[model samples]
Target: MVESESTTKVNVLMVGTGEYTTGYVGGGAADSDKGAGVVALTMFDLRRRNKVSRVGMCGVNGKKFAGIRSHMQKNIGDVYNDMDLTCETFPEDTVVDPLAYEVAAKAFYPGDVAIIFTPDDTHFAIAMNCIQRGMHVMVTKPIVQTLADHQKLAALAHENNVLVGVEVHKRLDPFYADARDRARSNLGDFQYMYAYMSQPKHQLETFKAWAGKSSDISYYLNSHHVDWSEWTLAGMARPVRVTATGSSGVAQSRSMNTEDSITLTVQWENLNDQKTLGCAVYTSSWAAPKSDVHSQQRFFYMGSSGEINVDQAHRGCTVATDAAGFASVNPLFMKYTPTNGMFSGQGSYGVRSFENFIDACCAVNAGTAQPRDFDDGSLATVHTTMQGTAILEAGRMSLDMDGRPMDIQYDGNDHEPIAIVPHVFTG
Candidate 1:
C-alpha cells in the first residue's frame, strides 16, 4: 500500500465508544478522574492537526450513539471552541450487535488504521479483523488476556504487513523515560524492581460488569507496571519465571469475584548470561480509598550500581478548594487546559503515544519506514511487547493454579525472542 501523496491522511475507525471514547459511562460522565475520556479526544485533536482523515466510532449498542455524540459535543467540542467531533457509527439505531466492529472495519482500506479500546477479552478479535482487512491496529494494554492470542495477532500482522501496537502510554512519561535510560546506562544490570499502581474503589463500579466475570484487576491495572518493567529491561534481562498472589475481600464484598489487589513476582534471566538472574515484584489494586489523586502509582527500581524511585502520584503539584477538597493533578497524561482558545494536549505523553502510532502508520504508508523499524522500540508493537504479554499471561495462570509459579520459556529458535507459556490454563 503506497500513499499517493506525502500529506495523505489515514482514515481511523474507533472500535469502542464507552468511557475512553465518549466518557458516557453509567449514563453520565465518568465519576472518577477522566471526565471526557482520552481516545476520542486525542483522535479529534489529531484530526485538527491534519494527521488523520475521517473518523468512525463503533459500539455494540447503537442506542447509546446519540448520548455519546451529545456528551462529546458538550464536553469535548464545546470545551475546545466547537471543534468538529463528527464521526460515523455502526450497527445503526435500535440494533444491538456485538459483531458491529466487523461492519465498521469494511470502511477502511489497507493503509488506514483502527484503534481498539474495548474490553481486554475483545481486543484480539477486533484487532485480528482489522489486521485481516489490511488496516493498522492499536489495542489498549494488557493487549489481550492470552499469550496465544498475542502470538497469533503478531504473526497475522506480520503476514499482512500491518502495524499492531499496544497502547502502553506509560513509556512516554518523561520521568519513566529517564528511569529507563538510567537503568540501561548508569544503573547497571537489573537487580530488583517493585511497582505499585492502584485506582479508587469507585472504578470497580464503573467496570463492575466485567471486573471478575471477564477480567481481573491484575489485567486492568497491573498491566501498566508489567509493560513498564518489560520496556525498562528490554535488552538487559527477560522474565523467565512468574508467581502470582492476590488479596481479596474488598471487591468480593461488593459482589465482585475479582482480587482486591494482585502481585506478581517474576524472575528475570540476564540477557547477556542466562546463568545470572534478577527479580521483579509488581503489584496493582483497584481497592484504594479516595485519595488526593485518582490513581496511586509509584515504583522502585534497583540495579547493580544504583537505584531509582518514582512517585508518579505526587508530581509536586497539588490544589485545595472548599468544594473539591485537596487533590493532586497530572497534566502529563491529558492537559485539559486550553491555549489560545484551542485544545493543546500535544505535549502530553498520553496524546503523544497515539500520535506516535499514527505518525508511524503514515511513514509506513509513504514507504519511508518499514513495519520492523517500529520493533526497534519507537512504540510498543506486538513484536516488541511479547515479553510483557508472556509475563502477564503467566501471572494470571499462576493465580489460577493456587499461586503455583510458572516459567516463561523464550524460544530463541525464531528470528527474534518469542515467549512461550508451557501450558497456560486461564481461569
Candidate 2:
C-alpha cells in the first residue's frame, strides 16, 4: 500500500444509514439531529474556513431507503449525483449492503480514510481492509465487542502506524472540554466520574436476542460510560478488575444470553486524591428513582473546586460550583434552529454529526489534525466490558424482579467477565 495525501479536498463515505434516518425528523427534532446536523455544519465550515470541496455519499447505487444517501443527494446539492461509492444497486435501501465495502476500497485512493459508521461487528473487516490497503480509518464509538478483537486491531495499527478513531463525538463537544479544563487547571485531578444510559429490558427483546444481542448493547451504552470516565479524568487507566450481576430477562423473554441491567465497581490504580465517576443504566424493569429525573443519558464529574453535568435528551452541559452558584450555567451544545445548518439551501446534507468525520478526515489528510489512536479505543472498549458486567449484576437484585427493595452489593470482581465497539482511535 502506498501513502496517500489530500489533493485539494478529502472524500468521505458513510457506511451506515441509521444516522441519516435520525436526521430526517421534521421540526425542532431535526434541529437536534446532531449526527446529520454537525456533519452539515462542518460542510459549511469547510467552505467558509478552508475553501475545500465536499466528497459525495458512499453506498451501492440501487439501495433506496438510506436517508444519509438521500440527504447527501439532496444536501451536497450540485455534486450529489456524482458521489456514489458502489457500481451496483444496493440489496435494499433500508438494509446494509455488505458488498459496498469492496467497492469503497476500490473507490477511494490508498491514502483516503474511510470512517466506519455501521455496527461494531462490520468495523473489524473494513478497518483491517483499510489498513491492509494503506488507507486511514475512523469509526463510531466502541470499535468491537471483544478484547481479542481489540488486540488484533492494536497489532495492525502499530504495525502500520495508521491513525484510527472512534466516533466519540462528546470529546469534541465544548461541554466535555470544560471538564478537561477543570482537571488540567489545578481545579482538581480525576477523583470520580459517573455515566448512565439505562433503558427498559423489554426494549431489548428480539427473537435471537438470547445469544449475542446484548453483545452490542454491552459495548454500545458502556462505550459512552467508559469514554466519559477517561475523557473527564484525562487519565486512561484500564479497569484492574470487575464483576457484574443482572438478570437474563431480555434473554429469558427472547432466548438471549445478555443481561438487561447491571452495576459495576471499576478499579483504576491511578485514582488517588481525585474522585471517580459512577456508571448507571436503565433496564425495562427499572423504576424511576424517588426523584423526578426521568431520562436516559447522564454523566457527572466532581472536582474539588466545581462540578459538571452532561445530559442527553436536553443536549446540554452545565458547570457549577457551590462557591459561586448554579445560575451562572453555560450552554455547551449547539442548537438546531431553522436558521441553523443549511436547511434553507437547496440540498439535503443539511448538517449532521457524520460531517465531523469528514472534517477530521480532511484535516488528517492535510496534516492539520491527527485522528485518535487504537490505545484510546482499547481503553474505553475494555472498561465498558467491565461495566456491563456490573450492570448485569445490578439486575441480579431482588428489586429487579418487580422493582422491589433489595440489597445491592459492591463486589470488586463481580462484573469482571469479558470485553465488548466502533471506536478505535485515529492518531
Indicate which candidate wins on TM-score. Answer: 1
How much does candidate 2 score in TM-score?
0.61
- For model 1, how does the per-residue alpha-carbon lDDT over 67-163 read when each residue is reduced to its tens digit? 8888888888878974788798998978999999999998667888899998888898999999988888999988988878888988999998888
lDDT tens digits by residue: candidate 2, 65-130:
454445544544333222222222234445566576776667666556665655556777777887
- Scored by lDDT, the top model is 1
Model 1 vs truth, CA RMSD: 2.8
Alpha carbon lDDT of each predicted model = 0.86, 0.46
Q: What ranges in model 1 sit over 4 Å off? A: 1-7, 412-427
**CA shift of 301, model 2, Å:** 3.1
Tell me how far the alpha carbon of residue 44 in candidate 1 is from the true structure, in angstroms, after superposition: 1.0
